[model samples]
Structure formats: structure tokens, C-alpha cells
Target: MRILIVTNYYEPEEGAAAVIITRLARYLARQGHQVTVLTSAPNYPHGRIHDRYRGRFSLSETRNGVRIISTWLWATPSPRISRKFLSQITFMLTAALRGLTLPRPDVMLVEAAPIFTNLAGVFLSFVKRVPYVLDVHDLWPDHMLTVGAMTERHPAYRAARWLVDHTYRRAAQIIALTPYLEQVIRGYIPGMDKVRTVYSGVDLERFRPGLDDAAFRAKHALGNARIVAYIGTLGTAYDCLTMLETAFHLRDRRDILFVIMGTGTQQQVVRDRLAQGDLPNVRWIEWVKYTEIPQAWAATSIAFWALFNHPLHRGAVGTKMYEALASGVPIAVALEGVVADILRESGAGVSVPFGSVDALSAAIRRLLDDPAYYARCSQNARAYAEQHFDAEKAAQTYEAALLKAA
Candidate 1:
């Protein structure tokens, strides 16, 4: 089937949304489907447009057998609410207009994030007379509210809720990233039979155990130290403060280095705190290319997955955990809900209560001190990824969802 995927994020962005969507597009293309991606130019996390697409309003390219069409957005690195809202609005308009001119496909898979992108998909679905599957990554205004970005009484909050519900009503089908997320969406839109859970799985081929980490370690100036890494967007939903505090508690261990990578709204906050403190064992990397992330994982001895203690974050099983598991690196997570459940069920790592620095620190120390336990967790990590987080299986499930919608 010919498929058109509409997402604000795409290849070269390095964010979880971009990586997941890009991988799915390539997988479909490899399976002999005519896959086309409609997205904004590569500007994410950092929010600065890539050099190649800097001055262009729109551009198109083909990568790995999939066609990628990108349009310009009002990109910025600012944390202000107005700037972000404007960015989304511009992308929503540009993507919809650009998508209208493209050849109609059998199905459109729309990633519903920033919420506005769904407007583009809805417009294209109505105008092109094609079915579109709404891939719901997060519940929008609820997430916004949870992160204290806005209140329920805020006009923007109400507007976002309306837009999300409208998209949910319009789509031929909806894809939730986790089963728990699907349940919550169903609760919001009762009797929503069309929604299905398709996890944001990891590419085992790209991330696996036994990669040479010496080069990675040498390049990072991290000689022979076991790294504990928090590698993803340092977004508002993440408890980065707790991660740092935990690191501070373990600063005496010179052999275990804490590495924080990626960029987001919370990056500056982390930087400011680091500047005010004396955490010699922690290393903060502003950015890392997506291609090098597997090697980053290779150099990591432990993966730190953290989220704020918020109800909205309960269903989120962020892509980093799966990637870590795939790389055979055990996790020390400050998480709840589905992610915490996965850690326990797989015996891949230990989960501490959100924001509990002492517990998190202790968990790390135990994993380091007990070689046999660490080895078991590492083995379980890879086994779990192989059994459940296979990228091929995820792509097939996504394909089935789109086909059903079409």
C-alpha cells in the first residue's frame, strides 16, 4: 500500500519522535510500500534548523527508499510558551498546504504531537479523501497541564483539548504507543474501538551488545570509567534534577561517571544547577548526533531513565529504555507505571521511586558492587529486547494499523 506519514519530527532530528517515525518509514519502504513522509525541516530539541535546509521554505529528498518532504517552521530554542506555540502553528499551516499538493496515498499515518500536526492530517484526510491513522504519542493538553505549562482554566488548554478530541473523532484509526496509553485514551473518548497499541520499539540491528566502546570512550575523554547515562531530550516531563542529585550522591565513585546528553527546555536549568554545584563526576553533553547514539549506549554501563512524579507520565515508556535494553545495558530508573513494570518483569534493572535520590544512588551502587547481579541484569536486558522490542515486529504492527484504516 502507498502510505503518507505526517509528523512534525523526522530524520536527523535525534529526538525520540523523529527516530521512531524515520525507522518506521524506512521499514515500510523496505517492505516494498511506497512510503512518503511529510515533515518540518530538521529542527528539534535544539530547535535550530539544519544548515542545508536553513534558507529554504520547503524541500524534498529520498532516503532509504522512502520519500521525505519537508516544510519550514518558525523554529527557535527559546523556552517561552509563545515561541513554541507559534512554531507549531506555522508547521501546521505549512505541512497541510504542502501535503495538499502531493499525490493522494492509500493511507496517511499522522503522528499526533504538539497536537497541531494532527490538523494537517485531518485537513489532508478530508481534502484528499483518504483514511488517516492518528498515532497518539501523548495526551496533549493533559501533558501540558501536568508539566505546569498551562492550567485547565487557560484558554490555550481548552483549545488544545478541543483540537485533540476533534482529531480523535476524525481519524479512521488511532495508534497508542503503549497499552496503558490506549486505555487512558479510551477513557477520554469512551468506546473508541479504533485505537490500538503499537509500542515505539528499538532497532536491534543498530543497538546491540559487544560494540567496541574503547573508541567511544576515548573520543569522549572518558578513559576506562563505567558510564551511567541519561541520553534523551531533557524535557519538562523528565526529573533531570533528581538524576543530577543522584549523581551528586555518588560523586565519590570516580570509576562510575554520570553522563547527561541531549537538549531541551530543561537543558539550561540543568546547566545552571551544574554551574552552582560541585559535581565533578558528572559530564553534560549538549548534543549528540542520532547516528552516534548506539555507540553512546555501547560506552554506557548503566542507563538512567527518569520521569517527574506526575500522573500523565505514568503510561510513558520512553524509547530510551528499549534502546538501553537492546544494547544490553541495565537501567536504574526513577519511573512509574508501564516503564517500572517493564523493568521488574524483564529483571533488566532496578526501579526507584521518582525523585528519590538516595534509593536511586543505592540502586546504582548495588548494581556496581554486585558483579553477578549486574551481569544477570545485563543478560536479561538483551533477552527482553529480543523478545519484545524488535523493530521489525513494531513496523509490522504499524503497517497493519494503517492498512486497516485505509
Candidate 2:
């Protein structure tokens, strides 16, 4: 099969979407399918185009046997809503135009976030008379509303809902990242037999135990300090402030350190709060390359995951959780819904109520204090990751769906 993947982000972007997309594209290509990706130049989280990709309207390259077509986008460092919306719109228009110039594929796999990319997929599918599979990483409009980015009365909200429903109806198949999201999609497009749940699996080869933790610790000069790390986009949906509060609560315990590594709109917010309060127990690092993530994980005793307390986030699962599990590092997540369920079922870590600093702090302290429990959770974490979140298995699932859709 000749497969074309359309997404707003791709390789070198250092996000879940980029990782998943790149993995699937390579997997499909290796499976003897001709896979192509249409995406914007690498500019995400930080929002500045990579130096190598800058000043290009469009470019194409082949990586790991897959063809990549990157187009220019309106880049901005600020994570403001207006700037993000403009970036998405620009990518949508340019990607669509680029799609028109490409050879028609057997199937088109569209990443649905920034939502407008699906519009381009729908158009291309119709024009080329090929089936398109909609891979929904998150539910738009609803997510926007949940994040307070849009209200019901907002014209954009109504328009987004309409666009989402239209795209769902037209899609040959819908891929939901979680079971709860599959249910939500079913509700939106009732009796839709095409929706399937394909989780964002972790790269087991890239994230595993036995890395040089001592070297990582020595490199950071984090002598004897137990590091609790949060590595991902510091976006609006995440409650970094709550993490800071937890840090403040545990400041008296000199052994515990909170390390936040990522860049987003909330990065400055975290910086400002830390500066004003002079929180010595916390450390902030800018985004690291994807290749360096395993070292970061090695430096962590506990993986900290926090999401804002919102219904929209209930169905979502962070890709970092699986990465932590794969690394044999226990997780301390502050969120509810499927992620919480996973922790409980897998016994890989502890889950605290979202935004509860007391609960989060206590959970962290408990794990650190109880060596036996920490060891058990760490062992369970790797086991659970291998059994449930293996990247090879996920790639096969995606391949089957794309083939069936085509």
C-alpha cells in the first residue's frame, strides 16, 4: 500500500504526536508500503522553525525509508491562542496545496489535532478518490472548551464542532488513542463501526532500564537528591503550578528535587513563580532532544505527570507515562480517568487527585520512603510497558487499520 500521513508536526518536534507519527511511518515503510508524510517544518513547543528547515516554502527528504514533505508555517514562540490558531491555519493551507502536487496514495492517514489538518485530508481523499483514516490524538472543540480556550457561544466553537462531525462522517476509519476517546467518537458519529482504539505506545528500545543513572546524576551534579522529573510540553492543559506547589510543600526535605524539562506557554509562568518564591528544591531545563530522553529518565527516581482537573482531559493519556514505565521508573501521576486506571491496574505507580498538592506530595514521599514498594512499582512498570505499550505491537495495529481502511 502507498500510505500518506498528514500531520501538523513530524520528526524532530519532540512531542508525542511527532514520535508516534514517525514510528508509524517508518514501520509502514519497512512493511513494504510506500509511506509519505506531509507536515510543517519542525517548529513546535518552542515554536521557532529549526535552523536547517528555515526559509523554505516546502521541502522533501527521505528518512528511514519514508518520504517526508515539509511545508512552511507561521511560526511564533508565544503559545498564545491566536498565534497557535494562525500556525495551524497556515499549515493546513500549505499542506493541502502540497498534497495536490503529490502522487495519489492508496490511503491517507490524517492526524487530528489543530483539527484543521483533517479538513485538508478530507479534501485530498475526495479529490484523489482514496480512503482516509482519521487518527485522533485528542478531541478538539471539546478539548478547546475544556481548556477555556473556547466557550459554547464562541463562533469558533460552533464551527469546530461542525467541522469535526463532518470529518468524522467522511473518514473511512477513525483511530482513537484511548478507549474512552473511541466511545466519545462513537457517540458523535453513532453506529460508526469504523472507530478503533490504537494507543500511543512507547518505544521500548529507546526507553528501558539499565542506563547509567549515576552518570546522569553526576552530570547534573544532583548528588544524593531524589529527582522527580516531568518531561513533556508545559502546556495549558498541564497543571505545572500544582507541581510547583507540591515542590513548595516539600522544600524542607532537602533530598527531594523536582525537575521540569520542557518548553511551552506555561514555561515562563513556572519560571516566574519559582523566581518570586525562590524555590530551591525545583530545577527547570529547556526541552532536550528526543535522543537524550533516556538519560533524563535515568536521572529520575519518579516520573511526575500532572494534568489540569478538567473533564476533557479525562480520556487522555500522556505518552510520557508509558515512556516512564518502559524505563522502569515508577510514576506519580496527578490526573483522573484512563491514566489513573492504568496505574491502578498495572501497579506501576500511584495516582493522586488532580491539583491536590497534599496528595501529590504525600505520594512522592511515600514512594521515596518505601524502598520495597518503589522496587515493586519499578519492576511492574517495565513489565506493564512491555505487555501493554510496546511500539512494535502498536505499529502493527495501525498498519492493520490503514490497510483495512485502504
Candidate 3:
């Protein structure tokens, strides 16, 4: 099978989509399928093109058996909707034009996010007569609305809805990251048989438990303190402010240290809070390369997955959740949805109400003080990952869906 994946994010870009998609593309290529990825030049979380690919219009390279074609896009670090829309639109046009010159695949998988990137796939499907699958990462304008990017009454919201709906109807298959998302899609679209749920699971070898963390801890001056970490993008969808506040609430606890690792648009919130006062027990690490993520997890005693309390988020599960479990680290999730249910079912961690400083602080304290409970959750975390979150298993499921669509 010849597979083409169109996405705004890819390898060398720091984010869940980039890491997961790269893993999937490489896995398909290894499985005897010809895989090619059509993406914008490396620019993500930071939103500036990488130095290596700086002035190029497009560059084609092959890595680990997968062909990668990266095109130019207007990248920005701004959190404003209009700025991001412009970036997505530019990438959509460039990717579509670039994709036309390549050999058409048996089937193409398009990532539907940053909102307009999937338009490239839609354009190619029409021009090249290739069936395309829409990988619905988020529910578009609705997700934008959930994150306060825009209002339902806005003209842009209406326009996005129309475009998104058109793509949904035209797609040969729709891949939802969660079963809840699949149900949500089925509610609106008539012929629901096309929708399927395929998680972007974690690579156990890269994320598994018990790595030597002495160097990591020593380098960071973590110093034997129980680390309660919030690792990953500090985006608007997350309640990072609450996590910081929780750290402040427990600032007096010298044995437990709070670490916020990763950077995003909402990073200013952290800066503002830090500027207001001193938080001796809190350590903030701006960012780290993807390869160092597991070591950060290894140094963690408890992981905090904080999502905003919104109805839309119930259908969402960040890839970090799987990574945390794979690392055999117990999570303190400030969410009550599919992710929270999975945590409860696996006995891997505790879920608290979002934005509650007391509840979050208490959860961390319990996990830290009760060694037996902590040990149990730690064991359960690895067990759950082994049973369900293998990256290879997810790629196989994704491959089957792509083959069926073709």
C-alpha cells in the first residue's frame, strides 16, 4: 500500500501530533507500505521555522524509510486566532500545490487541525482522485470555541463550520482519537460507519518505567524531593494556572517539589504568576527536546495532567496521558472524562475537579505520603500501558483503517 499523510506537524517539531505522526509514518513504512508525509517545514510549539530549513520553499528528504516533503508556511508564536488561521491557510495552499506533483497514493490520511491543513487533502482528493481519510484531532470551530478562540455568533466560526462539515461529508473515513469523539461525530453525520477510533499510543521502549533518573534529578537540582510535574504544552486548553496555584498552596512542603516543564501560548500565565511572588518549592523548566521527555518523567513521582473543565474536553485525551502511564508514573488528572475514567479503571491515579487548588494539592499529598498507594498506582500504570497503549498496536489498527479506506 502506498500511503500519504498530510499534516501541519511532523518530526523535529515539538508536540504530540509531530511525535505521534512520525511514529505512525515510520511504522507503516517498516510494514512494507510506501509512506510519504506532506508537511510544513519544522515550526511548532515555538512557531518559527527551524534554522536548517530556513529559506527553502520546499525540501524533500527520506528518513527511516519514510519520504518527507516539507513546504513553507507563515509560522507565528502568537495565540491570536487570526494569526494562526493565516498560518494554516498558507500551509494548506502550499501543501496542496506541492502534493499535486507527487505520485498519488492508494489512500491519503489528513490531519484535521490547526483548522485548515486538511483543505490540502481535500484539494488533492479532488485533483488527484484519491480517497482521503480525515483524522479528526479536534472538533474544529467547536474546539476553538471551547478554548475561547471565538464565539458561535462570529462569521469566522460559521465559515469554519461549513468548511469542516463539507470535509467530513467528503471523507472516505474519519479517524477519531477517542471513542467519545467518534460518538460525537456520529451524532451529527448520518452515515457513521466511516468513523473509527484509533489512539495515538505511546512507544513503550521510549517511555517505560525505571530509567536511571539520578543524573536528571541532580542536573535539575531536584534533590530527592518528591516531584509533582505538569509536563507538556502549556496551552490554553489546559488549566496551567491552577497547577501553579496548587504549587503555591503547597509551597511550604519542602519534601514535595512542583515542576512545570514545556512551553506554549499559555506560558505567559506562568510568567505572570511567578512575577507576582516567590515560589521556592516550584521549579520551572522552559522546554526540553523530545528525546529528554522520558528522563523528565523518570524524575517525576507524580504527574499532573490538567485540562480545562469543559464539555468538549471530555472527548479529548492528550498523548501525554499515555506517556505518563507508559512511564509507570501515577497521574493527578484535573479532568473528569474519558481520560479520568481510564485512570480510575486502571487504578493508575487519582482524578480531581479542575481548578481546585485544595483538591489538587491534597491529591498530590496523598500520592506522596502514602507509599503503598503510590506503589500500587505505579504498578497499575505500567500494567495498563502494556495492555492497551502500545504504539505498534495503534499503528496496525490505523493501517487496517487506511487499507479499508483505500
RMSD from true fold, candidate 2: 1.3
- For candidate 2, the per-residue lDDT at 138 reads 87
Writing each residue's lDDT as its tens digit, candidate 1 over 257-318 gives: 99998878888779987997699999988888888889999999999957888887888888
Error of 1 at 205 (Å): 1.6
lDDT of 3 by residue, 61-134 (tens): 99999999999999898978788888888999899889999997999999888667877888888888888889
**Backbone atom clashes (below 3 Å) for every candidate:** 0, 0, 0
- Every candidate's lDDT: 0.88, 0.87, 0.87
- For model 1, give the 10-residue run with minimal summed lDDT: 140-149
Q: List the residue pairs that clash in candidate 1.
A: none
- Cα shift from native, residue 206, model 3 (Å): 1.4
TM-score of each model, paired residue for residue:
0.97, 0.97, 0.97
